[model samples]
Target: MRSPFRRPASRSARSTGVVRVDTRTKRLTKRLQPGEIAVIDHTDLDRVAAESLVERRPAAVLNAAPSVSGRYPNLGPGILIEAGIPLIDDLGPDIMRLHDGQRVEIHDGAVSHMGKTQVIAEGTLQSAESVDAAMEEAKAGLAVQLEAFAANTMEYMRGEWDLLLNGVGMPALRTQMSGKHVLVVVRGYSYKEDLKALRPYIREYRPIIIGVDGGADAVLEEGLKLHMVVGDMDSVSDKALTSGAEIIVHGYRDGRAPGLSRVEDLGVEHSVFSATGTSEDIAMLMADEAGAEIIVALGTHATLLEFLDKGRSGMSSTFLTRLKVGGRLIDAKGVSQLYRTRISGWWLVGLALAGLLALATAIMSTPGGQAFLGLSGVLWDDIINFFRALVGLSPQSPTV
Candidate 1:
């Protein structure tokens, strides 16, 4: 009979590393290094968060909460499992007892302190089959989420109808958007790919760039200048905050903005916009009210699964915001796949060179042109002789 303690192939039979722990996945990922163990408290981790951790390439992921809680079919755990990163879930509150940066060894789904034989925590290893099973079960729970989302939407619409309709409480901004295209970037699903494909549009139109929260960092990574940034100010890098972009902190409807302190600590000038929607929604509204000819969105959530992954009760604000903007807004992915720029530098350069060669050939067919060519040959010889003399080399006579 096979041993009951057999380990999954995805897990390292024996691995040891220093632990980096955080209740927030974004903060933890920033400090996490390759080959180190990551300890997070995220339940039903979303794709964006999972992608961030995958980029770091950690040795293993230890979660205090269930990676897939069956609330919805979250894609995070499956992504990690497929990437060949070991995931041990539901290790319980005892796992949090371990101090940060402490050396630990993992073997056969057991975690033990380095230089000690005691197993501090044990968890079941997640596999493809197991994750798929959990997801199947989780689909049933999506109905509950959908109902809740609808209720939230109704409540939000009832409370914020005026703000959604008339763009009330929008703060004044220095960036001008009148009669020009606006590019509103969010660091959401497939943002990198979508951005990569929109290079031509960005180059040609030169749209005003508005980054939402950590999306500011994404803008900077693409080597584009940020005209404005709107968000709660969490998950954005200090470098991005200091990059001279106009900062608009997203505050609650009650006028409480928690992220203002970080901006103040940096000694940067910023404005506060008290609103009742996602930062992306606020950004779209701002661009629309500023009279942007067109608004291009990159990495903004559009699907039900995406909204669910974000843990939003409903997309009521987003829905109403879209209605407010009407036909002005366009998704980056759709635009990238459809829109094509007419001119390229190489094409223009080749055309210019072809035109010049044709003109030279036409000129050479005339008598005056022949005389000019002879004169030009004589001048070229003179230039060669001058260069030879400057280099201390004797000029040789032409061969007969």
Candidate 2:
């Protein structure tokens, strides 16, 4: 009689916890604690943001913007619902007024202060069925989104013609990437899994490791020293900046570099790479310009769905950049699968056993070999007899 996607009436369908509010979901994720209510202003939430929230195990997610908005079936809302976290959306800008650490109650799409009687605000409580319907609607809008994507791509190309076509404005880095394998890591998709999978490739090739923003933390988290950190410097931690990686701030072509001041304040030396795309785009551009022999990309978006999931028109740079670097570019997932450990432990053991067997065969085929074998057998028997006698047992006659 009732929809299965909706929570059952028997179970309490309310979330009560302290709220963590931020318009930037990436920055907010850094401080989100378990059971905390995340109050974000994200629209068409992407997979990476959803994954960060899932990792924090939030009590609920309250978005001031539409989670789907018919914007090409964004993956964030479905991830939250699948993780069993309640999602309340379209709460409007008024919800951002909620202060951090303010205890609140969320019930039936309404938010109320803890122990208060009046609802502060109400929103659409999204469930599995609602998200599914939204995704279908979003998919239909793909044609319109594609048209916009094409237009934006042309605009980006026109505006940054020199950079795209001629590789102009690329920063000169001390980290030598010429004729070497370069690993460019971005904090998107199944980055953790991809990074773990590339451990062997990373060890074997010892590629120049480059981390984009929070990806720097991902690198350091895995106990790897980052050779370079390239981004706007908004999402990366101070520890990552001080990690001794050459920090290259991604700046606008208009010369406005907001992230530079933060680096200056922290007293970390950095250079600015004036570009017109995402950090990952500039990272690849840098690698290509530096003449990297092979570029291994980890946690980067490579598909149309992934580009749309990022919710940015500037992803055109990624499309164009990939066209330029696609020859050398290999997805970390592919490398992990194709790469075999050059020397497997089992292979080594088998080779050792075969060598001993060959030696034994050669020894059995010769007179000198037979004499040596006989002496070895006699010595082994004598050693066993000596051990047996020391244990207070009468030794039996040695084998003939």
Candidate 3:
């Protein structure tokens, strides 16, 4: 039976293109080029991932997993569809069998190799109405998620209370945070605007910068130096990993750190902090334990929907970390809004120019000032004549 969302078979539907395949959406986006098809295994694709994919301008997206799983109203699929990019979902794990950079044709809801009559896999086309219905259904499931989140928070707190209090597994670092301000940046919602707003504060304070996972790239994008980077390191770029920042790989309490291998492969010096919390939470705790006077957070998730969208089971560590940091942690939005740049060098220069102009205006209104000006003009003409004579030119004014 034909799906309601599927368009009638057309010449464009049979369009053939080279396919770039990756289980990781972020990695796939990096390799995806314009006019090429993107094959990914991402489920419940988030907004940031969607934005990245949209920026690449791919011809179409082929997902091996459901783009909208009704877990949460993830905006990824909606974004692609709204941007006029065709999204084919649930092609099954068999789609991964397709070789990367291989030419493939997609038509009539089926994917096939170029110049072949055999269909490799089939998927349903996703549209605006389907995505909207999934989102509505997902909203109804939020209560269940909230309950589960609360339960998980309690369980996590019970297991990791000691680590939170004593700062266990936090390796010593060369970058000192003692009695200084620390800026913790996350690549979450409104991060760009928040970072832009904190420009003045960053310039004046020169706080220690801690980037969490993909947030490292965000810091680099803003042309800021990273003092420390904390995360599992899966989403970060190779450029950011080798950017000379102090790396603290987030490890499991069992002493197994998946991200450590990548750091070791790069031959970079790093430390490990085995804790049971989000990378952002660990970063904040690290700063507080290191004696930071104040900590400013950029792009940290605070809303319920944000947490759900990220597919976090619970925010126990986030809640507890905030409690531990207390008033020291300030939101970037608040800092940008409240903090104003003091009189800068340019402002002083402007003031000096204005004062000089005012004085000259007052001076010009006096008879003594007019007489001085007339005398000064006579002296200026004499100097000009002297220079002209030296150069062997006529002293009289030259005709234009």
lDDT of each: 0.85, 0.88, 0.83
Model 1: per-residue Cα lDDT over 1-400, one tens digit each: 2212233446548889999998889889889999999998888889888888898999999998898889888888877887889999888888888777899998867899998999999887787777877888999998988888788888888888877777777788899999999999998887877777888888889999999988889889989888888889888888999999999999987878978999999999999988777889999999998899999989888877888887655456786777788689998987887656566889999999999999999999999998899888877888888899999999856322
Please give the TM-score that candidate 3 achieves against the real structure.
Answer: 0.84
Cα lDDT tens digits, model 2, 1-400, are 2223343221137668999999999999999999899999999999999999999998889999998888687888878887888889899988999999999988888999999979888899888778877887778888988998898888888888788779777777889999999999999888988898788788778999999988888999999869999999888899999989999999987888878999999998889998888999999999999999999999998998899899988997899889988899998888988765467667899999999999899889999998888898889989998999899988878767
Ranked by lDDT, top first: 2, 1, 3
Tell me how far the alpha carbon of residue 293 in candidate 3 is from the true structure, in angstroms, after superposition.
2.1
Better of 1 and 3 by TM-score: 1
lDDT of 3 by residue, 1-400 (tens): 2223333221236678999999988778877999999998988888777777888998888899998888767767777877778888899998898878899989857899999989888988877677767777777777878888788888888988877788776789888999999999987776777887788899889999999988888889999988888999988887888999999999977778989999999998999888887899989988988999999989887677777777666465687788888779888888998766467678999999999999998987899998877788788888888999999999966322
TM-score of each: 0.85, 0.88, 0.84
Give me the overall lDDT of model 3: 0.83
- lDDT-best of 1 and 2: 2
Cα displacement (Å) at residue 62, model 3: 1.1
Residue 49 CA error for candidate 2 (Å)? 0.5
lDDT of 2 at 116: 93
For all candidates, the clash counts are 1, 0, 0
Error of 3 at 188 (Å): 2.3
Model 2 regions more than 4 Å off? 1-12, 340-347, 354-372, 376-400
